[model samples]
Target: MIYRADPARYDAMQYRHSGKSGLKLPVISLGLWQNFGGTRDYPSAMEILGHAFDAGVTHFDLANNYGPPPGSAEELFGQVLARDFRPYRDELIVSTKAGYYMWPGPYGEFGSRKYLTASLDQSLKRMGLDYVDIFYSHRYDPNTPLEETMSALAQAVRSGKALYVGISSYPEQETREAHRILAEMGIGTTIHQPSYSILNRWIEDDKTIDACGELGIGVIAFSPLAQGVLSGKYNQGMAEGTRGADPRGSLRASHIEPRVLAAVDKLGAIARSRGQSMVQLALSWVLRRKEMTSALVGVRTLEQLKDNLGVLNNLELTADEIAAIDEASRDGLMELHPRPSGWLR
Candidate 1:
């Protein structure tokens, strides 16, 4: 069947500029970090991608080591792009990253110029693209000189392998330095990808969010549901096939502590009051900040994608609701009792 994108795709969705860059991304972006890998079902993946694009989710985020086998997610997305989205290519914002153990070699995993340059080439090849919209250093390499990493990213822009460059999971100071280094090289740092959710607030505590806002770098939050913990899925307990139940998954059983579940329950109650699902509430909370340019969601099924998209129906949260959320989060409550509301404070 011929795949034509819905004509109304752009009508309901919202777009925000990536930091000070001219590029604008959808308020909600789809991430191929999981479920689009080799082990997943192909037709199902195609349906999800098609549905997402139809609903105006123009940004699709990927990384070199995203798949369990590495590089498979890009391969999968590449196939879908060719078969379904060839004509609408210009309408999409496709991004990928490198900076993990992509291969077993000394130069395979860091922010070195050699690794970043090579990884971008491999990623472009795997995605069957002339250039990606954004290329990111997946993580900050403590051992690599910051200049070296930013230089590699600058080269990507100069060589036209990527339209923009970004950093993921970098510390506050490193993010500032990266922007400075890239600017000196005549390139603007476009976006910052970080793990942010109701449960994971490290970016806030560490002031990375503040730094991005000050630097004019957009923030796209990954795991805004805290790897599905904020979805109220683990409230009852870890199900058989949930991420927490999978030992190899990033969301471990230990992450869903009793206190955390208690917090989620409180959050769920707030969601119900707002006539929203836990997923919708979680996403809305992440997007509440002006600095949050997008919430990057990874969904396993089309139904889950629909549920996530429903968040757009009620994107705004009242100030009192925000305060309630802060009180309920309990700072993920490491202590036996709840702490003062940091957000309210």
Candidate 2:
């Protein structure tokens, strides 16, 4: 059967400009970091991608090292793009990144011009795309000069391989430096992808969010649900099929600490009072920031996607609600995991 998208897909969704750029992304963007891998079911992944677009999620985020085996997510997304999203290609904002360890040897990873250029070519080939909407340096490479990294990103735009370029997991100072460097090259740093959640507020402490706002760079928060911890799924304990249970997953079992679960329960109560699910509340909180252009969500099922999208219904939070959340998130409760070294933070 042929797939037809809902004509009213733009009705309920909201869009915000990425930084000062003309590009506008859906407040809730779908991320192919986890579930859309080659190891997952093809039909289910395709269904989720279709439904997300049908509901006004115009942006799909990916990275070179997203899948378990690396590059598999792009391969899977390429298949979906060819089959179902071919007609709506112009309406989508497809972004991918490179910087992590993608393969063996020295040329496989980091911010060197060699690795970034080669990795992006591979990503475009895997996704069967002529040019990605936005390309990103997945992380900051201390060993590589910032000029070298930013130049590679600039070349991507000049060469027409990417419409825009961004950085992810960069610290506050580095975020500012990246923006300045890119500006010197006559390119704007359009967006910054950071790990932010009620349980993980390093962006707040380090002022990366502030830097993005000051630098006119949009922020798209990844892990707004703290690897499913903020979703209230682990309130009882770690379940067998949960992300934490998967050894290959980014969420480790130790991240679900007792204090973290306690904080989640408190936040869950706040969600109940507002007639929102845990997922909705978590997403709403992340979207509350004006600097937050979007919240990147990775879901396993259609139900979870719908629940996440429902955040748009009541995206605003009252002052009292903010206070309650702040109190609940006070102290070291947010420090569930150790801060990663260097730009990985």
Report every candidate's CA lDDT. 0.88, 0.88
Question: Which pairs of residues clash in candidate 1, taking residues 3 or more apart in a chain or in different chains?
Answer: none
Error of 1 at 171 (Å): 1.2
Q: Number of the top candidate by lDDT? A: 2
lDDT by residue (1-345, candidate 1, tens digit) is: 788899999998999998888989999999988678988766888899999999999999999988866899999889888888899999999999988878877998878999999999999999899999999988888788999999999999999899999988887888899999988899998999988888888888889999999999999998889889889988877788778878778775556888888899999999999999999999999999999999999988899999999999999999999999999997573211112111100
- C-alpha positional error of residue 116 in candidate 1 after TM-score superposition, expressed in Å: 0.6
Tens digit of lDDT per residue, candidate 2, span 51-113? 999999999999998886689999999988888889999999999999888889999988999
In model 2, which range of ten residues has the least summed lDDT? 336-345
- Among all candidates shown, the one with the greatest TM-score: 2
C-alpha-based local distance difference test score of model 1: 0.88
- How many clashing pairs per prediction, in order? 0, 0
Relative to the true structure, candidate 2 reaches a TM of: 0.96
- Candidate 1 regions with alpha-carbon error over 4 angstroms: 331-345
